[model samples]
Structures are given as C-alpha cells and as structure tokens.
Target: MEVLSLIAGGVTTAVQPINLMLIVLGVTVGLFIGAMPGLGSVNGVAILLPVTFLVPPTSAIIFLAAIYYGAMYGGAISSVALGIPGASTAVATTFDGRPLALQGRASLALVTAALASFVGGTVATVFFSLFAPLLAEVALSFGPPEIFALMLLAFATFVGLGGDDIPKTIFSICFGLVLATVGFDTISGEPRLVLFDIQGFLRGIGFIVLAIGVYGIGEMLWTIEQTRGDVTTTNPKMTVKGLISDSKEAVRRGWKGTWIGSVLGFFVGVLPAAGATPGSLMAYGVAKMTSRTPEEYGKGSPDGVAAPEAANNSASTGSMLPMLTLGIPGSPTTAILLGGMVMWGLTPGPRLFIDESEFVWGLIGSFYISNVAAVVINLAFIPLFVWMLRMPFTILAPLIFVLSIIGGFAASRSMHDLWLIVIFGISAFFMRKFDYPLAPAVLAIVLGPIAEPTLRQSLLLSSGDPTIFFTRPIAAPIMVIALILIFLPALKLLRRKRQVTQD
Candidate 1:
C-alpha cells in the first residue's frame, strides 16, 4: 500500500509538462548517441550532464535516467544492423543479430530486440519500485562499520568478477583510490595532494571531469584510431505491417529467453559493481544452453538476440538499486548518476526516501514513462538513427572532443579541469590498450571517499579499535563475504599455478 501511494504520487509529479518534455528530449538524444558507435549510456549521460545543471534536481535526474534507458534500446540497432555493438552491454547481441541481418531478417531481429528490451526494462522497474524502499529500510540499520564493509564488498566483487586479469583490476582500483585522496581531507581542512602554486589542484578533480574525459573523450580517441573508412549498415526495409507481424513472432519464439534474461539481469544488477555486461552475457549463455536448437545460437536465432537485449535492459534498471538506496553505484553509468545527485546537493542513502520523497519517487515514476517512450521512439525513428550511423567519424569525432571539453570546463569553469580531462583521456586510452577495466577505477573514485570517512567514523566510535568492523553482527557477516570475494580469485590463481607445476 505504501509503495502504491508513492507510485501514485510519483505519477502525479512526473506528468507535469516540463518533466514530460525533458523525458522525450532525453530519450531522443540518448537514442541518437547510443546508435553512434563507441558512445553508450555512460558517454550519453556524462556528456549531457552539464547541460542539466540549469534544471531542477528532480527534472535533471529524470532526464538523465531516461537517457540511460533509451540508450539500452538504441544499442541493439548497431549490434543488429552492423556487427559492431554500440554499447559493451550489446556485444552479446551481435552473435545472432548480425547473422540475422545478413540473412535479410534484420527487421525480425530488431523487432525482437525492441520488444524484449521493453519487457525487461518494465519488469525491472517494477521490481526496483517494490524492493528499493525495503532495501533502504534495512540499510538504515547499517552504521559506519557496516557501510565500510559494504564498500569493501563492492570493490572486491568488481575486482574478482570483473575480468580474468585480477592484477590490472587491482591496479585500476588502487589508482582511483589514490586519485580520491588528492583533494582536501573531509575530516580535516588540510590539502593533501596539492602541487606547489597550483590553485585548481586544491579543489580536487571533479567526477564529471573524470567521467567525460575517460568515457566520452577517451572513447572518441579510440574510435578514431580503430575506425578505417566509412561504415555502411544493412538497411532492411521495415514496414509497419512487417513490424507488427514480426513482433508477434518474436513474442512467441523469444518469451522464454526474455523471462530468463529479465530475472537474471535484475538480480545481478542489484549486486554492487556487477553491471549489465555480465548479466547480458550470462543471459545469452543461458538461452543457448536451454534452447533445443542450440546450434542456431550464432546463426541468426531470434532467441539469441532476444536474451541479451532483454538482460542488458533489465540489468540497466537493476544497477540503480544500490545507487538509490545505499549510495553505492553498481555500474559506471550509475556512478555518474550518483555524482549528479551529489552535485544537486541531494545525498543518496536510506534517508533519501524520507528527506526527498518527491525527488526519489518522481525519478522512479519517470522510469516507466521512459521505457515505453524508448521503444516507440526507436521504432519510429529507425531510419533517422540509421542515417545518423552514416555520419562520418571525422566529423563526429571532433564534435565529441568539443562537447567533452565543454563539459569539463563547465564543471567548475576551470581550465585546470580541461587539462585534467586531456590527461585522463590519454591515460584511459593507454589503459584500454592494456586491457585494464575502467569501470573499477571509476567505481573506486566514487566509493573511495565514502569508504574513508566511514572507516574513520567506525574507528572513532570503537575508540580506535579496528576490530569494530568484525565485532558487530551485521558488519561481521558482510566483512566475511568481502574477505571471501577478495581471496577466492587469488586462491583460484594459486591452484592453477600448482596444477601447472605438477603437470
């Protein structure tokens, strides 16, 4: 009943003209950005975040959140029409999507993707609305020690489960933690990492600057380096009649895959630092495993495209759980959202529901509106989006650079931040070259500050006894989980090495 009332109040708030317009605009822009190769939800949200500075907090969040969902829908376009995935989350879609396109069934593939995305997003949003408040209520019992333990768990999970290269992930996270310590100490007024005679260093690096540089500018640079010539897409002639017919076929054939993706994606997304990429990949694997025609998975199977599309979209919604409730971001895109919330002077956590009910509920309400809007907009504007794909990278690359520079400068109106963007962008390019994950670094930057303060407070509360983290009943279990996550990978590596030696 309480959840229903909040949902009702949210609906009432979201229907306002200004908010509704923002939602449409956000989805449109997000679709365009997401359709462009190398630009996904992270880049879409980061680049546009500065533009939202002039709007009200609730409206800004609603707009950004809309873009996030819209991009998930748009990513399927490139994956199906071309072999290239528009977003990392959509990579799994290409296995079957491109094959279907090659087989002249692009319309069926696209329709399936769109419909599955809508189902996944809507179901996940409903789950978010129902579960977030309960999670937040439970989180209210967490003190500083528990919060610290949770942050450790987040870092551990990402490092352990992110990729096969644990060392690179650890290095990325440690680098971010070091970056987090560069500015003034929150407990004390002392500046820590300020270089001599550099005024901007005192203000520290803005999250927006880092986000735009690493995701937007860095991505553009990589795209420029890799892309050789004008890319053309398979333009399948899609009519309204064909679309309606294909939609029915997709639902009939892909319903099981959709359900599998949605359930797995939502649960994985709820885990801190576990983003959409794994969820989508896992869903695709599950679909293939269960399919009677498993041999068709990589050869234009509709179920192949449906599963990943459904999972990625659902996971996108799921990633919002920790960000909204515990103030921990599950993905880089959510990290940007968390940063935006902070910039708007809104503190995320259990208290957010009580203190800013309107903002929280309003944002939640906008999710439903945006999910439906994304499908309609994507279907209606497919031609235009395909045209957008034909735009030269030479022209698009410079435009991205300009926007990234503008966003960096807009953060604090500082030239220093622009320079920082350039530095970070270059660093990110090199990191990408070495196969180091940027998400962990970004996550660490967001969580590092929070972890430091929480740890300090816990120590103070326990009268300098560090065992406080393990003494509390709730904190103890969480810490144990964290420790297990941290060591499991190392243990695996050790056993592998020992087996090789024996062999």
Candidate 2:
C-alpha cells in the first residue's frame, strides 16, 4: 500500500508538462552523447550538469537521470554499427554486435539491444523502487572492511570470468592497479608515484582519458590496419511490422540472457565502484557459460548483444541506490549526480526520502517513463543511424580521431591528459596486438582507488590487524566468497596438471 501510494504520488508529480518535456530533452541529449565514440554517461552527465543548476532540483535530477539511462542505449549503437564501443560498458556488446552488423543483421541487433535495455532498465527500476529501503539497510550495515571485501569480490569475479588467458588478465589488472596508485595517497596527503619533473603526475592519469585513448583511438588504429578497401555498408529497410516481428523473436531468443543480466547488473550496481562495465562483462560471461551454442557467442549470436546491453542499462539504474540512500555514489556518474544534488541544496541520504519524498518518487517514476521513451526513440531512428555507416572509413576514421582527442582533452581540460591519451593510445594498440583483454585493466583502475582507501580504513579501525577482514561478520563471508572465486581457477589448473601427469 505504501509503495502503491508512492507510485501514485510520483506519477502525479512526473506527469506535469514541464517535467515531461525535460525527460524528452534529457533522453535526446543522452542519445547524442552516447552515439559519439569515447563519450559515455560520465561525460554526458558531466557536460550537462552545469545546465541543471538553472532548473528546479527535481527537474534537474530527473533530466540527468534520463540522460544516464538514454546514454546506455546510445552506447550500443556505435558498438554494433562501427565495431567501436561508445562506452566501456558497451565493449562486451561489440563481441557479437559487430559480427551481427557485419552479417547484415544490424537491424536485428539494434532492435534487440533497445528492447533488452528497456526490459533490464524497467525491471531494475522496479526492484529499486520496491526493495530500495531493504537493500539500503543492508548497504548501511557494511563498514570499511565489508566494503573492501565487496570490492575484492568484484575484482575477482571480473578477472576470473573475463577470459581464457588467466595470466594475461591478472597482468592487466596489476597494471591498472599500478596506474591507479600513481596519484596522491587518499590516507596521507603525500603523492607516492609522482614523477617530480611533471606536475601532471600529481593528478594521476584520468580514467576517461585512458578509456577514450584505448577504446577509441586504439580501435581506430586497428580498423585502419584491417580494412582492405571501403567499409561495407548495409541499408535494410525495417518496417514497423518487421520490427515488431523481430522484437518478439529476439525476446524469445534472449529472455534468459536478459533475466541473468538484469539480476546481476542490479546487485553489482548496488556495490560501490562496481559499475556497469563489470556487470555487463559478467553478464556476457554467464551467457556464454550457460549457452548451448557457446561457440556462436563471439560470432553473430543475438544473446551476446542482448546480455550486455541489458546488464549495463540495469546496472546504471542500480548504481542510484547508494547515492539516494547513503549519500554514497555507487559509480562515477552517480558521484557527479551526488555533487549535483549537493549543489542543488538537496542532501542525499535516508532523509532525502523523508524530506524530499516527492522528488524521490518522481525520479523513480521517470525511470519507467524515460526508458520507454528511449526504446521508442532508438527504434524509430534505427534507419538513420544505420545510414550513418555508409560513410567511407577514411572519412569516419579521422572524424573518430578528432572526437577522441576532443573527448580526452574535455575530461580534465589538461594538455597533459591529451599527451597521456596519445601515449596510452599507442600502448593500447600494442596491447590489442598482444591479445590482452583491456576490460580487466579498466575495471582494476576504477576499483583500485576505492579498494585501497577502504582497506586502509579497515586496518586503521583494527589497529593494523589484517585479520580484521576475516573477523567481521559481513566482511568475513564476502572475503571467503572472493577467495573461492580466486582459487577456483587455480584449482582447475592444478587438476589439469595432475591429470596430465597421471596420463
């Protein structure tokens, strides 16, 4: 009854003409931002955040949240059409999305991505609305030790599930952790790995700069090397009837992937620093693991595209729980939203629901509304986006290059970051050449800083006793789970070796 009343109130608040207009406008802007290579929800939200100051608090947050949702859908567009992910979360989507596009199934891929994203976002939003208080209570119970354990679990899961080459994945994660440690220490004000000669070293490398460099510039370089001639373009006229037919077929084919992704993405999103990238990657891994036709995954499998698209969108919604309940941002984008909330004089936490019940429920309602709007907009414009692929690679490549440079520089407005992009771009080219999975490294970079601080805090609380992690009730079980995840692969390897010796 309470949930129903809140929903009713939210519907009333959100249906206002001005509020509805803002949702439409926000989704439109997000779609544009997400379609551009190297720009994702983080950039989209950051770029538009200042504009929200001019609007009402509810309106501003609603707009930003819509952008976040719409951008997730937009990220899929480029991944399928151009074999380039618009965001890190969309990287897994490219595995099968690009293949499907190449096989003249771009329409099917795009529709599946849109529909799956809608399903994921809607389901996650429902969970967010109904179970948020219960989940928030669980989240509030976690201290520094528990938080650290959770972060470790996220890292272990990603690394273990990421790829076939365990050693390479481990190396990639270590490399990222090293990069994350270069900046000033969170505990002390001292910088540990700063190159004294360069002032920018004090700031450390920006994740956005690295992401744009590696995924955007690196992809461009790889594409240039692989292209023999003009890129092949397919223009399939998808009628409404055909689209409806294909959507039903896609849902039938991808329901399992969609459900798995939605559940995983939601839970992962609730954990601090565990964002859509890991959620999507884990979803794709699970989809592949459970697939009867696993060999078709990296080919043109529809489930591959559906799984990650669903997971990323669902995770985007899940990341909001901490921000609203505990005043802790679950992801980078939510961190920005947290800042926006503070700037708007609205404090985020349990009081947020009590004091600003209207805003809270209204934002929840907007998720359902905006998700439906995004799917409709993406479906309606599929033909135009597909037509965009007709441009020559020679033309598209340089454009992507320029956009990547601009996006990198925009990340921090530092020339040094641009230089870092060039350096990392070159490095990523080689990494790709060596077949190293970049996703694990990227995940490490995001989680390392959070994990380090939490670990230190936990230690300080326990007088430097490392056993604190294993002694706490919540943290202990979580750490045990992480251990199981980490050791499972090693156990498999050892068993294989023993079998070989016995033979």
Candidate 3:
C-alpha cells in the first residue's frame, strides 16, 4: 500500500503540463546531441546547465535528465546507421549495430535499440518509484568509511570489468587520479601543479573539455586516420519484412538482454563512479557468456547488440538513484545536472526528499513517461534516423566540431573554456593513439574534486585518526564493498589471462 501510494503521488506530481512540456523539450535536445558525433550526453547536458539558471530547479533537473535519456536513444541511431558511436556507452552497440546496417537492417537495429532502451528505462523507473525510499534507508546507514569503500569498489570495477588490458586500465585510472590532483592541494589550499600561475589550469582540467577532446577530437582523428576507400552503402528501406524480421527476433531475444541489462545497469548505477559505460559493457559480456551462441558475440549477434542497448539505457535510469538521494552523481552527465541543481538553490541530499517531495517524485515519474515516449518517437522515425548516415562524414564532422566548440563555450561563457576544448581535443587524440581509456580519466576529473575534499573533511573531523574511515559503521561497510568490487575484477582478469595462455 505504501508503494502504491508513492506511485500515485509521483504520477500526480509529474503529470502536470509544465513538467510534460519540459520532458518533450529535453527529449528533443537530447536526441539532436546524441545524433551528432562528438557531442555526447555529458557535453549536451553541460551545455544546457547554464540555461537552468533561468528556470525553477525542478524544471531544470527534469529537463536535463530527460535530455540524457533521449540522448541514449539517439546514440543508438548513430551507431547503427553511421558506424560511429554517439556516446561512449553506445560503443558496445557498434559491434553489431553497424553490421546489421551493412546487412540492410539499419531500421531494425534502430528499432531494437530504441525498444530495448525503453524497456530498460521503464523497468528501472518503476523499480525506482517503489524502491527509492528503501534504497535511501540503506544509503543512510553508510558513513565515510562505507562511502570511501564504495568509491574504491567503483574504481576497481572500472579497471577490472573494462574490456581492455588490466595493466593499461590501472595506468589509466592512476593517471586520472594524478590529473585530478593537479589543481590544488584541497587539504592545504595551495596549488600543486599550476607551475607559475596559469589561471585556467588552476581549476584543473575540466571534465567537459577532456571528454570533448579525447572522445570527440581523438575519435575524429582516429576515424580519419583509418579512412577507407568509398565503401558500398547499405540502403535500409523501411519495409514490412524488415519490421517483422527485427520485431520477431526482438520479442524472442530481448527478454534476456532486457532483464540482464536492467539488473547490471541498476547495480552499477548505484556505484558513484561506474556509470553507464561499464554497466553496458558488463551486460554485453554477461549476455555473451550466457547466450546459446556465445561465439556470435562480435559477429553481429542481435543479442550482443541488444544487451548493451538495454544495459546503457537502464544504467542511465539507475544513475538517478544516487543523484536524488545522496546528492552524489552516478555518472558524469548527472554531475553536470548536479551543478544545475545547486545553482537553483536546491541542495540535492536526503533532505531533498522531505522538502521537495513533489519535485523528487515528479522527476522520477517523468522518467517513466519520457522513456516510453522515446521508444514511440525514435522507433517511429528509425528509418529517417538511419537514413541520416548516408550523409558524408566530411559534411557531418565539421558541424559536430562546431557544436563541440559551442557546447564547451556555452558551459562557462568564457573564451578560455573554448581554448581548453582544443587542448583537450588534441590530448584526447594522442591518448587514443596509445590505447588509453578516456572514461576513467573523465571520471576522475568529475568525481575527484568531490571525493578528495570529503576524504580530508572526514579525517579532520576525527582529528586525523586514520581509523576514522573504518570506525564509522556505515562508511566501513561501503569501503569494504568497494574493496571487494575492485579485487574481484582483478582476480577475474588474472584468471582470464591464465586461461588464455593455457588454451
């Protein structure tokens, strides 16, 4: 009955005209951002944060979150049709999505991605509506120790579960932490790496700048470097046969991917730093491991394509849990939204539930409607979206480059920010050449600023007692969880390497 009542309350709050309009607006912007190369969800939301200054916090948050959800859908279109991942979370989709497009199933791939995302998003939202308060209760029991543990666990998962080499992953993460430490000694209020007072560097490298550079510029350069001869184009004519062929398989194969993705996405979403990329990749791995045709994973397996689509989409929803309850963002995109929330004078911690129950529940409720709306909107237009890929990259790339610059400048209204964009872009291109993962670096940039300060504050409050992190019952458990998460992935990596050598 309590759960039922909460649902009712959420529906009442979210069904208003203003909130509904915001959802539509966010979905539109999100789709455009997602459709474009080099403009991902994080960049999209970061660009929009300033606009929130003029709106109510409730509207602003709802709008930003909606854009993220919509972008998830848009990313699939790009991957399936254009052979370019619209977002990092959608990278897994490229393995099969692009193949399906080459086979003239582009429309079907888009439809599957859209539908899978909808299923994943809807399931997660419903779970959130019923389970948020319970999750909050669990979160409340956590202390500094537990939180630190959880973060450690989150970082470990990235290294262990990321589908690349463990040593490189570790190096990437350590590199991120080091980069994160460059701005200032948060403990002593002294600059550490500024090295002669460059004002822009004093703030450390901005996450958006880094992301646009490595992901956007680096990716663009990589694509150009690998530029092949004119490839035969696949025309995905929107046909009944295509619809039937795809829908039948989706209905048959989607259930497993949907459930697996939703669960993985939800769990990872709860972890502060893991976010949708890991969740989607993990889901794809799990789906492959459990599939009847496991060998078909990288060869355009529909299930392979379906799993990450569902996982990343569900992960996006899962990320909202911490954002609403603890004021901690589960992903970088959410971190951008966090800034918007703070700017609107709305603090995002637990008190938000009580003082802004309507807003909280309303935002949660809007997710349900918007996710469903995305399926309807994107699926109906999959043909058009897929057709967009026929446009030459030469034409598309310039526009995306422009958007990346605009989005970066829009973030702070500063030309310095724009220059920083170019710097990061070049850096990202070089990092790509070295095969370093940019996600960890970006994660560090986003979470480090918050985590480092919290660590120092907790320790100081306890008079520098090292055990203070472990002494807090809640914090200790969370820390323990983090340790387990980190170690398990490392162990798995070792076992896999041994197995490969033995084989």
- lDDT (C-alpha, whole model) for all candidates: 0.78, 0.82, 0.72
Off by over 4 Å in 2: 46-55, 102-104, 229-242, 298-300, 342-345, 497-503
Candidate 3 similarity to native, TM-score: 0.72
Q: Which should have the higher lDDT, number 1 or number 2?
A: 2
Better of 2 and 3 by TM-score: 2
TM-scores of the candidates in the order shown = 0.62, 0.89, 0.72
Q: Which rank order by TM-score, best down to worst? A: 2, 3, 1
Q: How far off is residue 105 in model 3, in Å?
A: 6.3
10 residues in a row with least lDDT, candidate 2: 228-237
Q: Per-residue lDDT tens digits of candidate 1, residues 1-503?
A: 98999998887777789888998989988887776555678888998999889899999999999999888988888666544466667767876886776566777788889889999998898988998866544535667887688678767765554443888889988887777877799999898888665888888765556666676666456655765534333444556776788889899988888988898788667766556766786677667767888778768888988898999899999888789888989788999999999999999987898999999999989988888888898778755544443456566456556656764565458888888888898988888888887656665665677678889999999999999999899989979987887787888889999999999
lDDT of 2 by residue, 293-332 (tens): 8778878888988899999999999989989988989888
Better of 1 and 3 by TM-score: 3
Q: Return the candidate ranking by lDDT, descending.
A: 2, 1, 3
Worst 10 residues of 3 by lDDT: 228-237
